[model samples]
Target: MREGSPGWARLALLALLGSILVPLVAAGLRSVLWALVGIAGLALAAVGVWWTLAHTGVVRAFGVALTVTAPVAVLALYATFGMLWPALLSLALWVLALTAARTASTRGRTASGQAVAEAPHAPWVLMNPRSGGGKVGRFHLVEKARAAGCRVVLLDGSQDVTELARRAVAEGADLLAVAGGDGTQALVAEVAAHHDLPFVVIPVGTRNHFALDLGLDRDDPTAALQALSDAVELRVDLGYAADRVFVNNASFGAYASVVADPAYRDAKAQTVLKALPGLLTDEDAPRLRLRAARTSAEGLQALLVSNNPYGRAVDAGHPGRRERLDSGQLGVVCVRVDNAAQAARLVRGPRSPGLIRLSAEEVVVEADTATLPVGIDGEHAALPTPVVCRSAPAALRVRVPRRRPGTRRRPGTSRASGAAADWPRVTRLALGPLLRQRHQARAGASGSDSGSGSGSGSGSER
Candidate 1:
């Protein structure tokens, strides 16, 4: 119950209620038990306001810091649900009622729970209207902001998000929100930095990749809006490629070329038709020597820099992490492969080999024979010569809904794993020992630098 785990106590209560044939004495005993539960629930609620980390530590902070609003939230959810269905109580209400009545007197401690001050105010809303199936505009977010006593300005179309954000600050707008894609999310973040404003992110596009990383709601506009109410600001890291700020990832080699092509987008059939075989099996496709950041630089095939280091055995997309927004370092991943057989080996999934992951503050990328096509987040920009990417100072503040119990976040796949086997390895190169001096470790190859790091929180650095 403390973990918000679904248990059988509620089922037992339901059985008793469903059968009115139960004797009056038995019903009275059931009522007492329910009352005890109510007490425990309320006690936990009170403790939450003081508990900094609810879902971790000795019990593992199971929820986000925003859990301080638990009392109001739980009641709101139940009242809303009960209006729709009377049985909603028999299911979700009884459990909560018991907690509220039984645990109303508990005391707790704090984990940096400070009330916000009015002076020096700067607020931001980083909205990805193009996320989560592009349903953001329907959330009526504008009204919600006004209710909170904040100025509201919506960014849409091809407007320069960063510049608009700057102007918003000039116009005395302390808070900003962009209704758009993750690419747009990054742009808004860059502007927020100019004003030193705390950004609140609204996920309204497909995937909501960055939203997921920040433990925010990809759905539920109300909860996302509510999260911005008592915003307890935290600074995460930002990645930079030249002048631009990327919140999630950066990629080089074929990824840049693929995403840059207008014809390759959204149309899965066409993307596969053109990208596959053309990259892996085609002899005419371009290649490059790879070098992973903060590791022994290698003249392998491809290169990638992530927002954070990935875990071994974790899929490129599912790097299980504790802090996706820690602002200090970056993650670099790379793979080396030469032919199709090795490509097939890497394609087997889960066991992709020769995968190297590195953590560093910065890295340098260059090409020998040709200019490298780089994808900075999802937006394709001109190829910079000898691109130098580094972790930017502090982090762009964005608001996201807290994580819910048992939500299903799908794991990300490497380029090869996501697509055809034709182009498995990045290119031909030599693997060298890292700074400590280690030899080559041999195995298969895959989309080592396929920008899985972007999913973490840092946008593409390319």
Candidate 2:
């Protein structure tokens, strides 16, 4: 609109460039990603060819490199080398950046290349007073968040979070952020969905499981804060049990019992440690019959489910071991072990083995014998058995760093680095129990009306 002013021209150039280039960029980058991925496949294929040629002994040990003619010895023949294709996506991005930059707009001006500051509206910051050795006290994360356009609020032991969040949403807030445990994370998510605002998850609690999944840095609140300004809003699917929302998953049976134990609050570490000896030593733990809605099922000693089927287990199943957050499915994992002896034998150390695993849209679980306590997304709850599990189908919107396609590394090389997604700005309203009931009533009334021959209000009498 302006005559060659760098600001307006650049804006116009970017708008035009984005419109013309995004698809082309998407297509081109996709090709590069697939190309690098394909190269990786070729490399693996070449290895597989070599592995096939080598029947055994020393020949089996060495393999030929696909990209290079140089022969590799058995030292290089790792099964994991093939999986590097996906990981190599990071390399493909730099190539893409160069290519995209080469195709210039007629305006010929490059992006300002400066990462913009992320200032979220209505940020709800909740901290856990009891988490990870009280690390929040050591770090002034709240003050830092306040400095970065965040409306900071503290969580006093999960007291009235839904209420506090509901109030924030009512006051025209656009983001709900939590710096606490998974329990607090899910609670904040509930209010975020209630108001339909973007929820920022700052992992201050123990493990920071979901944080790792989103490629966020738990140790650095600034990186998490940068996520507010740096990444796009992904409408991630949330798992629901009863009235609560779960970014992780829900399980009934073994872990449920452990979580439900009142002493678990105090003896979580000790109890787990004590239980580990028996679980590893003995091969017997309580065997529970498992059933899902209208599906053939098996018996499990301890059943655990994640929002997404977790990635290959590492770090005793905590920390680095995180599930795919955007799979649009819930992961169901079932295990069988009875008695302390059997549990010891069946349980695989701290990180449990994934068994009877599958991604299902919905699951209805019930047991034949005793009622089961349930653990939903690392939070405890009680159900009378026959618990229902289903995907919420894009219910929660979260802010996560925009990663370059085909790689796990954060986008830093291109102008698009730290570019958050432009989310659809929507109004947030915490649907009160009364309002929720009214909404249900309206639906019922509408259903009844639809069942009958209904006309316009006044004219219906005729």
Candidate 3:
């Protein structure tokens, strides 16, 4: 209708129909029962996996067995019933339908933005040479920035980035830009915001979450440099934990604890696997109490406070991405799954009691311990109890290329996150055009009748 894609909606509906019909057609009515069993088994497998991560000894071994067997059992049943192909095909179609539905729903949506007329006169850029496995050197970002008439400073991991930004500002730098990870981006962004200067982002980091949210091209770091010539300024919010700034998010409890381990940097997967059982089950583990506007959650095993709320569905392209950075609210996701039952309930999606998602202007996290370990933008820290995480609404002026891949504002195009699709919403959107047309026809008929009545009254008066 007014927005989204009708073509994609048709495709999504077709795929959805196929997802259901394929299994039924191939394996008859019994396939429905088999499908239900498969779903239950998957849910059980999820619970089992959670158990293995959160328990030790016999319980952990049993969880491992359950995790391995549940999915295998489902497959075995499908194979024995000669419904394996149909089941797999149905699952694939369902996934495709969901993806198409998301695209259809989000299509044609564009973000409101402000255009910049003039470029910065004296823009200063900071590049971390080692970031993204030396992306700066690999792309020759330093030389390219200088070529674009920017004063460049290459970070050697020795100097304070905040001080560098401050020095640049003191020396009459008009704009601040960074070609590094989110942690470094936060450091410079704070300085830029303090000075009320425009900040630029070059997505040369291992994971440029901020850049992606801003609709910048993460694959082409050099494309961001074009902003110096033609730019659009977006006033976005920044996340803060106490006095520290975080462009992405501040993590507490399980994730923070994992990052705090000295061995994490060397062997991340091994470290997380080794530490999960203790962190998830230990009674002595730091329990966090989180308070936000109109809501409070206690005894959270892990909590993430982001600059803006992340979409419920994970984006196949960019996992854990926020739909908008300018929401002026902190996104809070609290997890407290303590048992297999609670873990199994996760199949209910966002409605599960074990998982909580909300948004607030501010959040306060309190812990029994005097200091709590935190992971701010993937960097570990220890913050005092009663840590305050707040959103600074429209605090940073982010300069981005006017023409970027992720921000093309056109019909059948959108800046919205292609995360998980909401099926109900998608269904409504698919029917929107017909609904609008019917309403319009009724309104027009009513208007005509009113007009005729008015004309008759005028003639009678005359």
| Candidate lDDT (C-alpha), each | 0.51, 0.55, 0.85
Query: For candidate 1, what is the TM-score?
Result: 0.57
Best of the candidates, lDDT: 3
On residues 1-462, what C-alpha lDDT tens digit does candidate 3 reach at each position? 235677777778889999999988997888779878987998999888897898778887889999999999999988997989998999899888877876766632223467899989999999999999988888889989999999999899899999999999999999999999999999999999999999999999998988877778888899999999998887888999999999989999999999999999999988988899888878787788999988998889999998887766234566546666777889888988887888888877788898888889999999999999999999999999899999998899988888888766432123444444667777777778888999999999999999999999999999
Candidate 3: where is the Cα deviation over 4 Å? 26-29, 57-62, 107-111, 313-317, 408-424, 438-462
lDDT of 2 by residue, 200-267 (tens): 77777787766666656677644666667776666667777655577776767666767776778888
Instruction: After the best TM-score superposition of candidate 3, give how far the Cα of residue 120 lies from its true spot, in angstroms.
Output: 1.4
1 versus 2: better TM-score goes to: 1
RMSD of each: 24.6, 19.0, 3.8
Model 1 ranges with Cα > 4 A deviation: 1-131, 290-301, 312-322, 344-353, 398-462
Best by TM-score: 3
Choose 2 or 3, whichever is better by lDDT: 3
